[model samples]
Target: MSSSNKPHYEADPNKVDYDEGNNRWTFKPRGLSIIWGNDRRYWNLPDQSSFAVDRTLNYDMDYDQRSEALSGPHWKGDGSSISSDKACPATCRVPAKALNIIWGNDPRFWQWIKLSEVETRSVGFDEGARLLQVNWIEVTGKLPTTMFNVASTTKYEVYYVMKFQVDAFGWHSVPIKFKVRLNGQETAKNFVLESYKEKHDVWHEICGGEFTVSKNAAGVVEFGMFEVKSEWWKGSVVLAGWSEDDVSQSQQTREETSYSQPRHIEETSTEAKLGETKLKRVEKEAESKAPSGSTRESSRF
Candidate 1:
C-alpha cells in the first residue's frame, strides 16, 4: 500500500491531530473533566473537547443566569431612582455596670454554665450559630458569679434575656412554656415563647422578669425552660443576664485585696457568705440607733 493511500484511522476518539510525515494517527482520549465552583451547581468542563461536550448540560449557564438574577435590584420598579433612608439611631444606652453573658455560641465566653437535658448544636449557614436544644423535659443552668456581687442589706435585681427556636419539622398542639428560676425559686411566671409551634425554624428572643436577690443569699441563681406537654419538641436556648447596680464598696474592697494581696483575703469562705456576716453587723447598728418606745395608759387620761 502507498504511504499516502495507507488507512489513516484513529483508534482513540479524543485525538484531533494526524501525523502525515510518519503516517501514524495520534490516539489521545478526549477527557470530560469538570471544574466545580464553591456551589456545586456552578461548574465547567475544563478538559472537554467539541466531541465530548454534552448539549443537554446547562450547569454553567444556569449558574450564571441565577447569579445575574440575584444581582438585580432587590425591590421592583425604578430601583435606581429609589432613595435609601438613614437607619434610626439607638435611643437607649447600655449601663456601664451592666453584665452580659452569651453562652454556648461564643467559645470565648463561659462554658461551665450547664445546660441540663439539652444538647449544643450548630445552626445557620456554615454552622455560624450555636444553639442548645432541649432533648428531655427541661433545660437548666446556673448564673455566673461575674454577673453580680452579693451585698449586705442591699437588694440586687437580676434580669435574663434568652433566645429560643423550634425545629422546622417539629410541631406541638400547645405552645412551649418557659419557667425561669433564680436559686431554685421561680422568679418569672411560666409563659409561652413565640417560636413555639412555628412551621419553619426561626429564632425569637424572650426577656424574663426581674428576680430580686436578698442580701443573705449565697447559692447561684438557676434558669430553666420546659415544654407544657410531653412531646418530641426541640428548641435552642441562648442566655444573658445583668445586675441592677454596680459592685458595692465592700465587694470592691474584697476584690482589690484578692488581686493585690491574696494573703489578706480569707479562702475559707466565699465572698457571698462574707457579705451575709456584714449584713448582720449592719442590722445590729440599725437596731442600736432606734429609740425605745413604751406603751402607757397615762396618755388616755
Candidate 2:
C-alpha cells in the first residue's frame, strides 16, 4: 500500500456520535490497539484479561473474532467504531481524534496503519497510530461539557490507551508527562517508563490525572501525554485512543466492568493504577535516569 502523510482515520471527521440519553460521545476505533481496555465487549480475547488486545490472548483464550477482520463481528465496516455494550453504560470510549495526537498527520513522525491486512491473529482496534520516530511526543485532548455532560460534584478520570512496540525506544531515559484539568484545577505527574519499555507489545493505560465536576466549573476536562524536554528520539508505539469513566464508579465496579467472566488476578490493573509508588514515578533528574537493567516486569500509575 502507498503511504500518505495524513492519518487514514481522519478521512471522516464526523465519525463520533453523541449518545444523548447516556450523556456521552460514542468512540470510533480505527487503528493499532494494544488491549481492549476493561470492556470485553471491545476485545477478541476471552472474558478475563487487562489492556484489551492480542497480547492477552492465551492458549485457552476464545477469540471468536479470529475468524475474520475486526470490521467483522466486532468492529464497524471501516474499522471506525466499537460495538456498543449496554451492560457497561457509564464507560465512554473516545476516539484518537479526541486526544489530538501531535504530528499524527505527518508520515515522518507518525502514520496510521491498518491492522487487518498485517495481523495474523485477532488484534485490537481497526487502525492504530504508528510513531515512525519523534524527538517530542505530545498527545492532548479536551472533552467539553457540551459533549460529555457528567453529573455535578462527581469525579472522573481520563486515560490515553496505548502500547509500545517491540522495537520501541527512548522510554527508559525520559519521563512521560500525564496531566488532566477541570475548571481551574489541574493535576499532573511524571512517570518513568523504565520498567515498562521491556514489556513491549502489550497494551497499557497512562492516566492523565483526574478531575472533579462541579456546578460552576463548566465540566470541560483536558488531558495529555507528553515527553518533550528530554529530546530523546522514540519510536514504535501504537496508540488506540482514549477512555473515560467515573473515578468513584471505577473503584467500586472494577470487578464487574473489568472483564466478561471472572479469573484470578493477583494484582488487578486497578491496583497498579490507583496504587502508586516509585514503580511508575519519575523524579526531577529524569533525563539521566536509566533503569539498572534489572528485569522488572509490571508497572502502574
Candidate 3:
C-alpha cells in the first residue's frame, strides 16, 4: 500500500456510484488496490474468466469470480477493504458459474449474464444464470459441512437467491421445489413462483429449508431448485445465485457482513444420477411421509 498510488489508476464508473442528482462516481481514486477486487480487477478488467470459459469463445467477458467466494475481506467502496470490516469464522456463496446448473452452459437452454453494475453491487454476485427456455429445470449447489464449526445446535439456512424476467412464463401451475439435505437427512419445500410474478425483476430469496448443523454431517450439505417432473417449457427467469448462511451472520448490516475466509468448492461437485445428464426426470415419491429425523413444513408467501 502506498500513500500516493491513487494517481496510478482511475475510478471505475460502473463500480462507483453515479448519482444523476449528485453526479457521483466521478471522485478521484483513493489508492491502488492492494489486491484483486470486485469493482476493479487485477487491472481495469470487468471480471476474470476461467480457462474453460475463455476457450468457449462466446462469453462477453469472463465470469466475475470475485463476487462468489473469496479468501479475504470484501470491499466497501471500490475494492478498499476497511479495517472496520472484520472477518467472521467462515462462510459460503455459490454464484451461477459455481453451481451445478443443468444445461447452464448451453446456449439454447440457459444464458449466463454478467451482472450489471447495479446487480453486482446490490446482489453481490458477478453473474447470473438466466433460463432461456427449458423443459427439465434443475439447478443444484452444495458445500462441505466442514466449513462450519462442529456445532449441531447452530441454526443455518440455504436460499436460492433469484428473480424473474418480465416475460417469464410457464410457471403458473407447476411447482418448483427447493430442497436441502444434510447428515443424510433432508427437507423439501415447494413454491409456485408464478405467485410472485407480479413483482418481476425483484430478487426473492426462496428459502430451501432451515436446519441445524449436525454432528453427523460430513460430506456436503446438498441444496437446489428443481422442477424436473414436468414436461412444461419454462423461460425468462434469472438464477442469480445461492449460499449457505449462518442465521446470525446474515443479520448483520451489509457493511458489517461477517464473511471470513471464503473457499470455492467444485462448481459441479454434486454428482448427477444415471438418467439426469441427458435429461433429469424426477419420479413422484411413493411415500408421502418424510424420512426419519427430517421435518416437513408448508411454504408460505
Tell me, by lDDT, which candidate is best: 3
Q: Put the candidates in TM-score order, highest first.
A: 3, 2, 1
Q: Model-by-model lDDT, in order?
A: 0.31, 0.51, 0.54
Locate the minimum summed-lDDT window of 10 residues in model 1: 87-96
Measured on C-alpha atoms, candidate 1 has an lDDT of 0.31
Q: What lDDT does candidate 3 reach at residue 233?
A: 81
What tens-digit string does per-residue lDDT give for candidate 3 at 1-301? 3222343343334333345774443322222243332222122222223222222121232333321211112111111211222122234556666666655655546766888887777767777878867766667656666556655556776767678878888877466766787767887666566655677887666566666765555666777777766557888888877765677775553346322222111211232222233222223331233344432222211
Candidate 1 stretches greater than 4 Å from native? 1-137, 144-147, 150-172, 182-184, 195-204, 235-301
lDDT (tens digit, per residue) of candidate 2 on 1-301: 1123322212122434565775765433322232433232222222113222222212232333331122121111221243334113255666554346655654546767766543312223466777767765777766654344444666666666566777787766655667777666777766555455555776565555666666444556677777655546788787777766677776554454422221111224443343234323433334345334322111111
2 against 3, candidate with superior lDDT: 3
Name model 2 segments beyond 4 Å from true.
1-89, 116-125, 215-217, 251-301
Clashes of 1: 1
Candidate 3, position 40, lDDT:
24
Model 2 accuracy (lDDT, Cα): 0.51
Model 1 earns a TM-score of 0.29
